[model samples]
Target: MKWTDINDIAIELADSQPDTDPLKVNFVDLRDWVMALPGFDDDPKHCGEKILEAIQQAWIDEVA
Candidate 1:
C-alpha cells in the first residue's frame, strides 16, 4: 500500500491496534505504525500532515 491508501492502512491499524485510540495518536507514532504495516511500500518522506490527518480520520471511521 502507498501513501494514498489511507483507508486500507486504517483498516490494518484498527485491526492491529484495537485497544488504541486513533484520535489520540500522534503523527510520529502514526507514521511509524503505517510504515510498519505488512504491505506498506511508500517513501517516508512522502508523508505530510494532510496525509496523516486523512489516515487518522480513516482510522476513526473504521473504529466507529
Candidate 2:
C-alpha cells in the first residue's frame, strides 16, 4: 500500500496497535510505524505532513 492508501494504512495500524492512541502518536513514530506495516510499499520521501495528518485522522476514525 502506498501513502495514498490512507484508509488501508489506518486499518492496519488500528489492528496492529489496538492499545495505542493515534492522537498521542508523533509524526516520526507514525511514519516509522506505517513503514513497518506489512504490505506497505511506497517511497518514504513521498510522505509529508498532510499525508501523515490524514493517516492519523483516519486511524483515529478507524478506532472510533
Clashes of each: 0, 0
What does the lDDT come to for candidate 2? 0.99
Which residue pairs of candidate 1 clash?
none
TM-score to native of every candidate shown? 0.97, 0.98
Over 4 Å off, model 2: none
lDDT tens digits by residue: candidate 2, 1-64? 9999999999999999999999999999999999999999999999999999999999999999
lDDT of 1: 0.96
Task: List, residue by residue over 19-49, the lDDT tens digit for candidate 1.
Answer: 9999899999999999999999999999999
lDDT of each: 0.96, 0.99
The prediction achieving the highest lDDT against the true structure is 2
Reference-based lDDT, residue 10, model 2? 99
Model 2: number of clashes?
0
